[model samples]
Target chain A: QQQVKQSPQSLIVQKGGISIINCAYENTAFDYFPWYQQFPGKGPALLIAIRPDVSEKKEGRFTISFNKSAKQFSLHIMDSQPGDSATYFCAATENSGYSTLTFGKGTMLLVSP
Target chain B: DAGVTQSPTHLIKTRGQQVTLRCSPKSGHDTVSWYQQALGQGPQFIFQYYEEEERQRGNFPDRFSGHQFPNYSSELNVNALLLGDSALYLCASSLTPGKPQHFGDGTRLSIL
Candidate 1:
């Protein structure tokens, strides 16, 4: 079973527009939610993360909005740029970041110049 | 400081052969974790090593094994390889078992 489910397998957005991706989880044991960005032929890089205690966390133009009660979270990128085009993955883990990660399939985002 | 580094960036093997991949963790890191990522799919955890011992494992089989040296470097060994084993193997390291992990470019293994 896929513990974490992500939506919009792929997305396309214009430069400077808002880009959003959604995810839902079934395991209440999950307390840490992290987003990763991966370019082709490279490893996934940490982007932003949030814990159940917070409803939202923002860094630069990337933001993660988490809902513990609803078991859902979303990533919103403000003013998307061409450089932002890449594959994004949302992952969840237990034991406060000490455990193995359960990842969603991933979303391929494209920002048109 | 150097980030996680993996050796033998690419390899090709036929079925029934065995292969070993190596990894050197980032500076000051002591824990190593391995993952397998198939084409067009997200990476799946293989196992993790800390203090020269296997601390956690995913749902992989015995064919997949690993070792951690005292210096914090790690190696992944696969025995009786199959075509289905073809994938990009990743190595991630953290200062401790629970800290944020830094990943390497990964070793691409193709089985014929």
Candidate 2:
């Protein structure tokens, strides 16, 4: 019940296109959802985040579409560029408790120019 | 303000050896969390420290322990290590609970 399941282990998208990655979670205690982006040999960086109260949140060209009822969430990158190619991870954390994050396996997105 | 910073960048150890990784949290941040990221896998929570005490821990064994100083610096110690322990150790810091965390480059541990 603490795991976040992310899909599309790897994806290839063309430049100026849209890239999407999906994640489903099992733990209902989670109230916070976030997406992270990582380049080679670098730590994961916070891309965007959302809460159960809101269905969607956008930052720049990145957006998080959340489904509280379905326990699912996804990340959409508009105008995907080569620099956007990186490993993306979806994660969740409960409002209370230790505030530890539960992360999915990860998705490697490759944008071809 | 400086973000989370980890020391040694990389380390190598053999079986039965012990390793210690250090972390300096971002300025004005009081919480520090440690994670282990195996190849092709996302970072897994190890533990968290606040106010110089370990507030929470994950599923790791007792061989994995930690300490936090009054200055908000933290250390992760792994004893009796095995080859399977090889992975990237990441340090993340946040200003408040439920807020986004900032990560350091990470310390790569290679066990032989």
Candidate 3:
């Protein structure tokens, strides 16, 4: 079973536009949610993360909005740039035991000039 | 201050052969985790190691095994490789099992 589900396998947006990616989780025990950005030929880098206690967390151009009751979270990039084009993955962890993170299928975002 | 490092960035093997990949964790990190990513798919967890012991594992086969050394470096060995085993093998390091993980560039393994 896929613990996490992501929408819009691929997305394209104009420069300076807002880019959005959505994700939902099946495990209510998940407490940590993190997003990662990966470029070609490189490893994934941490972008932004949010815990269950917070409804929203923002860092510069990246923001993560989470809904606890709905078990959903979304990542919004403000002023999206061409360099922001990459694959994004959303993951969740239960915060106990071994803390294995269940990831969703990545969403490829392309920003045009 | 070095990040996670994986060796043999690329490799090719035929069916029934075996392959091994290595990883060195970042400075001060003691935990290592392995993941397998196929084309257009998210990474699937293989297993994790800490203190030279296997801590947790995912739903994989017995053909996949690993070893962690005293220095905290790790190795992944696959026996009797098959065509379906071709994928990018990634190694991640973290201070603890539940914390943010730092990843390496990964080793691409192609099985014919």
| Model 2 per-residue lDDT tens digits across residues A1-113 | 43889999999999999999999998889988889999999999988888898899999999999988898999999999999999999998997424799999999999999
lDDT of 3 by residue, A25-101 (tens): 99998989999899999888889889999999999999999999999999999999999999999988886425777
* Reference interface contacts recovered per candidate: 0.72, 0.72, 0.62
In terms of TM-score, the best-performing candidate is: 1
Which of 1 and 2 is the better model by TM-score? 1
Give the interface-residue alpha carbon RMSD of model 2: 2.1
Model 2 chain B is weakest, by summed lDDT over 10 consecutive residues, at B93-102
Interface RMSD, one decimal, each candidate? 0.7, 2.1, 1.8
lDDT (10s digit) by residue, model 1, range B1-110: 89999989999999999999999999999999999999888889999999999999999999999999999999999999999999999999999987888889999999
Give per-residue CA lDDT, model 2, range B1-112, as digits (tens).
Answer: 6788999899999999999999999998889999999999999999998888888899999999999899989999999999999999999998865557899999999998
DockQ of each: 0.83, 0.68, 0.67
Show the lowest summed lDDT stretch of 10 residues, model 3 chain A.
A93-102
Candidate 3, residue B18: lDDT: 92
Off by over 4 Å in 1: none
Per-residue C-alpha lDDT of model 1 across residues A1-113, encoded as one tens digit per residue: 88999988999999999999999999999989999899998998989999999999999999999988889999999999999999999999999989988889899999999
RMSD of each: 0.7, 1.2, 1.0
RMSD of 1: 0.7
